[model samples]
Target: MINSSPGTSQTRSITQTSISQTRSFTTVSLIEMWERFGYYGMAALLVLFMIDKIGFADDHANLTWGAFTALVFSAPSIGGWIGDKVLGARRTMIAGAIVLACGYLMLALPVDTLGFMYASLGVIVVGNGLFKSNAANLVRRIFEGDDARIDSAFTIYYMAVNIGSTFSMLATPWIKDHWGWHAAFAVCCGGMLLGLLNFALLRRSLAHVGSAPDDEPLRGSRVFAVIAGSLALAASTVFILQHKQVAVACVYAAGVAILAIFGFMLKTCDRSERAGLIAALILTLQVILFFVFYQQMSTSLTLFALRNVDPAFSIGGIALFTWSAAQFQALNPIWIMVLSPLLAFVYARQARRGRDMPVAAKYALGFVVVAIGFFVFGLSGRYAVEGRVSSWFMVAGYGLYSFGELLVSGLGLAMIARYVPARMGGFMMGAFFVATGVSQYLGSVVANFARMPAGNLDAAQSLPLYTHLFFGLGWLAAGGAVVAIALLPLLGKLSRAHQQATQAASRRESLAPAPISLNAKNV
Candidate 1:
């Protein structure tokens, strides 16, 4: 019984097609911003929470943090599919909001048990899956055929995400320092509730955006049932995967399964699609490498600041403020917020001059810059003597990392849209995130090398450990850059071929005759 009345539909369609014409885009941005705020708020506190409250060893904490982040980003694939095929985006998104708030509520209990933590993470993962991708999908639906505006819209959308992160990373840590850990976590829960309210209140604006376009659809209560049942099954699967004996096997199995599915899809697709898929797979590897470097912010990098960095700032000999270890994470997004516009202009200028860089070359550049960040990080240890390193060190590292992030991540999404057929775009996008999720876990594994001696490492041990890890990370990223550069020419050729095929197909479709009526078909 979705309203298909002409006037209502027309109003919603106009809003969807024109970002400035309605409040819909703003509503979606607020939802995204608030949701990210809640998520990052919780994330800012997680490793510290595990270490101080749960009394987990550094190694165990790294593992748990890795698993948590991996699952959080990973769920989007299944969640995206569920929304598309079963519940539809709007309903799935609303349901996810409720669950996400619940997940944070669980963490706000002040209990220090691993069981609750794991379960809470599982719930959040599921909730994030349902919410994150579908919310972005709604943005696409809003802009529909307005391809020119969609990129700009996503740039704005990503800025909102960074804005939320910047605020939460700064606020949550301060709250935890002044109030208490549970209070800080409670703030995360409250933020999610705020997001949920925004979503519900703005439903009218989004009414035309997320409704399924397919002929056969799961409607009303059936949608809820399918989502609920699927979530339960998925949640149970997460618990089983959490088992230590099976965790690695499960990760491998999941990776293989996803690969096999995509391989089958490629086999069945037209020639151009297969070429695009191949190119996408190649590009996805570079993205995974970038995220591996990026995710260190949460793991080894956070720990580095906590154990070694001095966070005090002063202006003209007057003490300004001291930032908490977790607050150090804000630097990445803060840099993003400050630099993205400048970077956008540079990319545009390059394109205008016919000096537009290939995506692979950009990826190579991103990897190289990240390597420099890690190299800077490695050098920071010498600047740390008694237990404290200069704050400028992390600032410099994040500055470099942010520039690389600007170059790669935004274009990664554009690549999918550029190379793949519209029919397969969503699936490819999900795969991109899945690669990210995998990298989060791998990043943790890389971080394991820097794990403190049993509990917390004194400066003597920490300096060498972090130094060694950074050196290795720098080299790892440099290696990825080399590989990407080596593959650039091939990727370029495949991408051009896909673009040509897509243009040809579009032209044919444009020229094709309309379908006949039943009587005309008989005649």
Candidate 2:
């Protein structure tokens, strides 16, 4: 018979603690899903709306979109810093959600002026910075220590992200088609509010996860000072983007300087520190390329769909496939939902067989898939002839890209934690964000080139230009894959010390006496 003494009560308490922690994680995952719904919903329409409604040229819309998205990546570094060193994760997330809500509201204003969009994007970027990293960090806190479950947990969490995107993708574009972009923007605002409400409801359960480190609270009055400095910088950026030539130059320069700091700071570290940072840098660069390819969802691909993709379909006598170009954005998340689970199972089975795929291998595979996708796009462009190619081709490419995302893009944050030391984990996470920021800028450059008029070519003859661009993108992805494969041997070298450390941990675990049950220990 099971013991029913005071000791048993103590064991029950420990079990309860674990149960509550798991539930809190579930709450966090739900909130993250809702937050993604809001963000991706807005993103689906942001560029097209800027071009069509705001009357910017395609080039201008693409550049501004890139800049705004780059800033979104940049804010995470600052947000991670603040969450770790000042406001704590929970409070920072609270502040971020509030700011995000306000930003969306600003976008909803009927005027739709330049200032409103800039200010609104700024709020969203800064807010995302504060909230995004903290939410991931809190997930880490849910588990007591590094273990295999964390991997599975992240996979489950990532599924939630795509699942959330699925609903928003379907809804946002439909709303924009019938009610206009304002209604679409408002829907995202409502999604943001829902995330906030979810967070508030779960606060009691999540208290242990998001508190800032004991040593990291904001210095007296410094919080206000940091806020002011960030605001000034944002205002300056808005002024800068107004100048066409300077925007690209400025983003590149800023990206280099930020990364150099990370590089230099890592160099000064102890061996473990240096190794972890190296791993982080590699992970970060891979992610940068991941986003660069991913961001096309809003720019070249959207335009491609608008101009060339034939969408002749009828769904139960209702016309389908003639939806706005932005509506194609919904397809990505839907694919992710279908693909991620299958991929996760494959990965788990490999791990169980002691042949687990390395992060680098997955990243390399992703680039290869991206290259193939781009090649397909080029083929589609070549055959488009009179007008848009079949929408099914774009769908096929997006499907491949979505699978590539499951392999790398969605695996990033988890990989960072696995590789980095606990002390500087957040900083390394920031470094990952910085890499993505650079990629966003680079993607803009690529998009700008794609939109540029080819010499001696009339508007009627621009198909070759797009074909060449797609071919170029395919080459870039292929080149990246080659380089990444060449560098594969180096990951093992870099991870050697980590492997040794893990082995040491395993030895200690084997030799040490088993931990007493909580009941006996308490008694």
Candidate 3:
């Protein structure tokens, strides 16, 4: 056999590495897709389910969802740390998936009691806390050191979320209509099971990647401890969800705690790390604002669809198809899927040319479009027929909102990857989710501004309440855009400092002498 030249061998090696990377990323994406399928499937119907079945009033339902979601998002902070320190990211993710599947199965049980529902939600909260950040950290690890690839990869990864959500959001509502609520929840359980199976089949694709713990054999004692702690946490979550006052207190406390964590990190980190942490903190605040807008899709917007927006897709006088109100939530993910590739292409191209827009600037631009989207929602009222706006308006508004999301929330994780150090990646990712969780609770509070008054209000009576809220949200987004723009110069300075410090550190590493080997062969 003829020996290959170095050049040919190098090229072949690179090709194989690329293929492995692709396979690993694809496995993670598909798993995340299915997780989203189950989560969004349940989310699409949860508020409505509470209102109709549990007899929760409008405000109560909105706040309860908000509180539950806040806890759901916040749980990731501890989970991410666990992934980094206690369990391997890969193992933690697998465990979380299993827990989530069990949670959905609980919802599938034929119980409509308040206690049962709250317990089911608590289980989901625990699972999400464990699953969300570790899964994201895995993707970050897969493309470590390549900032350009990180952004593009996360954007595509985000598209996976929408892909799962779009199908579930549409299907679950239809399933609820055709079969019943519990049957629909069972479908969500089935999706998670499918995800777990898919992950198992391709698990070896990730064999070469994970946290420090992955290299160590798992201890039975550690596993037992984690399980016991998780059960306690799950029970606490049930109590938290049941008590709105406690949730409010927890949200505020968490908000303050995150700020303190950032301040402490900034104070303690090396010069090389300080600027990056500052940049991340600023960007994290922007993400919080963006998610507030996001929260409306499930709370205020879905309720608006239920009351004021016509649910039929039509052209002239021809009706195409009619969707239930909850199904309209699918529009956000649908538009996300449509926009993700286009944005990813643009990001990759810009990165190649070294002309990519700064993340802060993107946030400003995101808020501008988010404002426009809300304005579209507000304006839809102008042409309403007997207080019912055409479904096309929702489509148009969601498209714009989704575009803004691409700019802001879609890049949020990429921002963490770009700025935060690899060692801090898992925990900071959790912190970012904590910020989003706080905003989710705040968003629900915001949704209450248009909470329907008790009694059966006609569509005409309800129309103005939503329109007024939409217009106010538009202005809030506009203000956010202004603030983001105002911070760009500061962000630019910080970004430069971070880059320079990073390069200087890299030079130190490269120029340093190699360690002397003490082995017998070397001696």
lDDT to native, each model = 0.77, 0.75, 0.94
* Residue-wise C-alpha lDDT for candidate 2, range 1-523, written one tens digit per residue: 8768898899998789779877988888888898888888888888888877888877888888888777777777777777777777667767777777777877777767888777778778777777787777777667635445556667778888888888987799889888888888888889989988987887788866765553364565866865786677567657656775676676777668667866776877655456656766776777777787787888888877766666664546666756567778777888888887887787777777877777788889988998898888888865674755766777788888887877777788778777765555555566677667778867876876668452434433656656677788889889888978887888867767666765676687899997878796689
Question: Which candidate model has the greater lDDT, 1 or 3?
Answer: 3
**Candidate 2 backbone clash number:** 2
lDDT of 1: 0.77
Worst 10 residues of 2 by lDDT: 452-461
Q: What are the models' TM-scores?
A: 0.89, 0.88, 0.98
Candidate topping TM-score: 3
Give model 2's TM-score versus the native structure.
Answer: 0.88
Which 10 residues in a row give candidate 1 its minimum summed lDDT? 209-218
Model 3 residue 470 lDDT score: 96
Native-to-model Cα distance after best TM-score fit, residue 151 in candidate 1, in Å:
4.5
User: Candidate 1 on 323-394: residue-level lDDT in tens?
Assistant: 989999999989988876776666666666767676777788888898898899898888775857788888
Candidate 2: residue pairs that collide = 308-388, 308-389
If ranked by TM-score, best first, what sequence of candidates would result?
A: 3, 1, 2
lDDT of 1 at 405: 82
Better of 2 and 3 by TM-score: 3
Q: How accurate is candidate 2 locally (lDDT)?
A: 0.75
